[model samples]
Target: MNNLPVQWMAEQSQRGRHLCLILDSTAVPGIHQALLHQLTHEHYRSVYRETAVAALSVGGPFIFSIDSLNPSSLNELLEGQTRDWGWLASIENHSIAILVKHWRERLLIGKRPQQALYRFHDNRVLARALAHLPESAYPEYLGPVISACFWQGEQWATVDNPASGEYPVPDAAQWLATPAPVNQERAILLVNVGQYLLAEHSEDLARLPEALSPRAWLIAQLDLAQRWGWQTPEQLHFLVVERLRETHTPGIKNWEPRPEEHAQAHFERLRGERFPEVKTWR
Candidate 1:
């Protein structure tokens, strides 16, 4: 919360922009229901309402008035959020419908025949996009957004909305027909998978082998794990512990054809056979 500066909020309030908390329904369990219980100061609107992803309205990003979040309620929401709490950004005079349209427009990528949707609510994607996108792209990326302050790495980073407008300023559709000249597909994948690990396998992440940094270890295992049908975080954790070692280089066994058992069961079977240096290797 400290990273969300009080002065910035005050300034935005003085300028008549509504302070909003952008929380993803997919990130917080029962978020839509929770909003029902905490609407004293304001309400919530799903970004999927009028967009191409409308079918996923129940599981998309929501923009809610900041007044709705309080100590106990916020803590409850954070319990489900894990490492990443959704951040704060202010909108100008735009209505919720307009803002939702703006966000929904962003979810569209690829060409006419090959449309794909990435999680715009993903903070890592937001951080990477806002940071790496070109200057002209800012207006395209953040239409009617006056200010955005969100966590970036170990500290806070703020994006200046140079094209803040009172009216709906962008037809993101215009830019979405073709891909961005700069493709961030790889960045999106890494951010999303890293986010998944942070959410579901923090213990494994903390115990990562010193021989490889967390990101490097993730890169090393990502493809193999996917190929081996190890998609769950628990399965990924098994890979992390088994393949990534603390003191020595990874000595992961290259098993042919994934076994038809749980990751732990597979590891236990290997271990029962007096697997070489399981402990010493990791």
Candidate 2:
């Protein structure tokens, strides 16, 4: 089985983090399935195995299982009271950012099982975020607030690309909103790079090298905030788009654009009033 050692499970023991293991033997076959099943056994650790909806109905430490995950499952996991997420070689592109935002919020609100999410694909990024844990509870919600704002802008690139959904584009104002947290210690303003570019003749405002590319703006934003005395805005996050190279039925591998490039391209296209360096990126 393609399993990491059982000791890796110790990461969840940290305060304010609950891990939910989503099970799908069909989604993952061969060694992946075998490893996950090992975790489910008595020798492994805490696990839950039910659909997201069913998982919500019970007390957590949820070893929840989902047959397949889509927007519907994403909504259930967030909207439902039991907020737990365990990734076993199965994290989808569309869902992760949104789920992370809410999980951060739940943690800020002093909710138990403060959500701990880890993906096998990008442990480095996860490690970095975890390293900057909030000293107080206020920024937990703010992180998502900032993250969701950036995610919407990134989504545009994918949805509007002809090779992508190629969906009709809408006014940026219609789709984007400021982070709505009550305590103003942290708030983010998402400027639509594309929208701003079309309106203004030049992109001088985004000329600075430090300005993050659109795809990676969220991470950059958080880093920028931390440097400039802005507390980590709860959970601001970034999203990007990537084309699928091959087709796998039932469950296909997901991908996203490189964040740093996305931020830079988007920024270069915008022409607007000078904005402060909101965050930084490593």
Candidate 3:
């Protein structure tokens, strides 16, 4: 095993930071299984106390250590498998520090071919850091992690290869005009807005519910609006609806009746002749 930098280990230990070392087993086949065997041994238990080693891939190993290790010995162990193991030291509830062996060096879990070697406090910071790396390096799991960390208390979900058909965009006009309580309608609208935003931003939202919590959706909407320079929620809402309408009903021009027209007579017509269409649409 190659020795990790002693000075670095001592410095991190003095700061009482938890350590998370991510190793790419793909670089050295069977490295993850080998390391897992070693790290899980009772003899090495003390050294890797409170450690968690996850096989991010068949060969990739992501290790989290609650206590610091002897850098020299740790490196020596890592060297037995491969000289490409990545090290990260983080303080609980604080920030994470990445070891930059060199520019253009690859890490087990980093943005893909040319992974950026830098410290990040949390997923949000990491997301920004990932942006600097090649798109290939960006991991799928990190998307939800970034969203969850950046927007605390808000539910973050992923949609793998999202398309309009799987998670069809709700008809905004119909959604608003649904015979529901005002709050319920607003909730539905907000969720639709969030779905639209998620689709626009990343195709990952389709894996999640079409709608999350309304309050969280509102927060996300407000933040997105501010970021996109939209002045108001209504403005954002209109944009979302228009986009959905275009996607779902491309050939059909806006056939939704005006709000004023959705009165008693409108309900009667809907109840009578349009009952089948209305029921089918919902």
**Tens digit of lDDT per residue, candidate 3, span 1-282?**
322334444554666544444443444445445556656432111111121212122322343342434455354434453343333333332222222121112222222221222212222223334434444333322221111111111221211211111122223212112244455334434543453344343333333346654345456645554444554344454434433344433533333434666333443343344224544232
Compared with the true structure, what per-residue lDDT tens digits does model 1 show for residues 93-179? 545556667776566555432334666665656676776677666766677677876655566567777886434435453333324
Note each model's CA RMSD in angstroms: 13.0, 20.4, 19.4
Cα lDDT tens digits, model 2, 44-155, are 2222223222232122222222323222333432333322122321222333333333332222121222222212112222222323433332233122111110011112
Candidate 3 Cα outliers beyond 4 Å, as residue runs: 1-4, 29-31, 41-56, 66-69, 77-82, 93-282
What is the C-alpha local distance difference test score of each model?
A: 0.60, 0.26, 0.35
Give the Å shift of residue 52 in candidate 2. Answer: 17
Q: lDDT of candidate 2 vs native?
A: 0.26
Ranked by lDDT, the better of candidates 1 and 3 is 1
Please provide TM-scores, in order, for all candidate models, with all chains considered together. Answer: 0.55, 0.20, 0.27
The 10 consecutive residues of candidate 3 with the worst lDDT sum are 144-153
lDDT top scorer:
1
Better of 1 and 3 by TM-score: 1
Q: What is the lDDT of residue 172 in candidate 2?
A: 30
